[model samples]
Target: MISTSPRATSVAGEPDAMSAREVLDLARSQQAAEDAAAARKLEAAARWADLHPPQSRHHAASFTLDGIEHEEAIAGDGCPTVAEFCIAELGTVLGISTTAAKRLIGHALELRHRLPRLWAAVHAGCVPAWRARLVAEATIHATPALTPASVAWIDAQVTPFAAKVGPAQLDRLVAEAIARQHPAEPVDPDDPHPACPDGRHVTIDADQVGFGGTTSVAAQLDLADALDLDHALQTGAAELKALGSTESLGARRAMALGHLARRQLALDLASATRLAADTDLAGQPTSLPAARALEFHLHFSAGLAGGLEIDHLGRMDEGQRLMVLDLVKSWCGDSHTKITVKPVIDLNTELTAPGYQPTGRQREQIALRDRTCVFPWCSQPARRCDLDHTVPFDHHAACDDPAQPGATTTSNLGALCRRHHRLKTHGRWQVSQPASGVFRWTSPHGHTYRRDSTGTTRVDSDPDPPAPPNRSSRAA
Candidate 1:
């Protein structure tokens, strides 16, 4: 039986009876049209605002959802870890791209951390819903790695300056301070030619300083030359003089000096000219490398030999001399050295070592094998993807398959970006090396897929349309 209720009426019908099913369908269609119109109106309004200059006319039509305030449970109580879990699930199980999932989780986590104040600013009619997000980022959740304490600190710091300057400026200051306080440790080729056959080393010297830290390459190298190598002894029976009586020379400086000495003695050596030149902060060219390549420090480690206790350049051992000679050879491959600038490191710790001890053949092979990134969706060329161990040597020895040996074997390596490397290590993803050059990806949800060297589809023969969303189906 069909009802003649006004709710079921399509219009002021001049008396035409309709079934309940037809009436409901007509009502739904009308509601959908209304929604579409509203959406269009909102979009048009936004576009109009973009073109026209905002004045009194912009606020001519304003409305609010004024009633009573409502309460909701605060976030951060229920699994702030939820976003990370979701990212892992989406990346691993759903077969969604890890990059897309990572971005989604990043935004969700950011919102969760500061939804309270963000929502309040919007409710007061002071800002738009979109503006709330901008405010959230500018005020509440400024950085991706903001802790509760950091947020509180930021709020306290910004309240005093919000009127004079702006939150963006404050963000820059905070970022700078954070960087100054905790800079990254340089890691790469300590001795790119560990087995150079010829006993040659490159000695780098200079001073390095950050916000409040300094490394004296010259002073530290002096300490290493004063140690007993055969018995790992510091033969200072006399006053047992400490490396540095001055407050300036810290443990880091000592370590720098020690490492520098060792670098000099190694069969291969080179200054991190490329790395130094790349990070050129304006106004402070000396901090990186625009002036001298690296400032030679007096102190540094001497590999197996003890630390250089004092400045003694002439007393360098046969190994150290060989290292210096090689540096000269590398610098002046033809005849006279063309390099005008000497290396300098005011702070020893600031020095960076050269990259891996790659044989020319090994490099050539790597270039050929990895033409580009190996990640499924990543189209980044070979230049971008870093060569990484397919089966990380860090994983337990028991886990490594005995069938595959050699560290330099092509079968043991693949290319991945820095982000994907983090995903594999920290996130819930697994890469299987069942066969040589055949990479299989199983989503967290157990959906298996494969990609070959050509980065082309290697799907089994299946002549059919795309399968519905279910495990028992195959992708078209």
Candidate 2:
């Protein structure tokens, strides 16, 4: 049974209580509700936008002089320019941030003025509101704005497939629209268009930083350029081998790329002689004047069977971890990289500090314990999250009686992202930390969720309701 305690939100019943058909129907109903909720949220934001039109007499609303231009371009022509500060007010009510609220308002305005067909479809319930919003968001925030005609075309193309279209498909459609919307130039009907295409490009996979603390690099270069690069890398690798380097060809090639980036590659035999002189018999540099000190936060593992986690570089197994570390050492020796071994924090111990702020060590302890924000569905890193007191901190009592020491302990505190922290503070969401790193969250809609290190799960009211698996069995 789910708790009816003050902290727990009262939920209806369990999903396991229902038959397969009933469960299927429940899924359909919930999807409908979700669609309606997204619609209402957009409409609410639109209403707020309408209410807060840019006042003629209003003074500078921007925080800085540099932000004025951006503030002016917040909305398009015919879309009501919303008052700047009002966005934050709406965000507080919606349990989102000002930036999110701004985006929502912009999308709504884009739908209303720029993409009317999509707007009509959204209100008619012909399309899911979020799908329509995604189209609007793409148009509203494109690198260079799409024309009204282009937006209309996009709306027409996407309206039919809105029910099942994915982001990639939508992005392609949007890109096509943007490409068709050309720059200002008088049309020359007789202009010759060549079919020539040069798709040469270099791309570093910045989005997916690898688990072994390395970035994947790909390049499509001109034939001559590729050959020259290959030759330089080969020469560098040969020179390193001549200087008694023991790294594999691929590894040395990667190191050569780094050397190229730093312009430390030996171009000729004379340069190679100078490079050799700089290196000692151990194949290590005597002194690296421009060597950079790097910091790597490695979480120690008791056994090789378990993976080791390095901050920014997910988790890696023993062999992979060792290989990556060796690469790191090659880049900068032990003397160049600072690896401080601090005492392991006692996770079970409830650490505390005075006043509202946690100590640096205490913060680190919480970051290690939670790993992410304790809010349901939020995976923001704890290092970037606010450590919130589950219960409201009573400043008078806390300061007056040192004996009580209420909410400052690890048992009472948990990591909450800024958005969720505001939600708990300003919005009606309630949270409780029953143990260190374990958070129980109650939504404004009366849904209860438990969030721990493993992730969030719903707290159902009933585990085994008095019902059989099938209606036929129950009838029998």
Best by TM-score: 2
Candidate 2, residues 115-194, lDDT tens digits: the string is 88888888887788888877887777665666677677777877777766687887777666666664445556686864
Model 1, position 50: C-alpha lDDT score? 31
Top of the candidates by lDDT: 2
lDDT (Cα atoms) of all candidates against the true structure: 0.39, 0.66
Clashes of each: 66, 0
TM-score to native of every candidate shown: 0.30, 0.55
Model 1 lDDT, full chain set: 0.39
lDDT of 1 at 258: 44
- What C-alpha lDDT, on a 0 to 100 scale, does residue 247 get in candidate 1? 31
Off by over 4 Å in 1: 1-100, 116-360, 367-372, 378-386, 391-407, 422-428, 433-438, 451-476
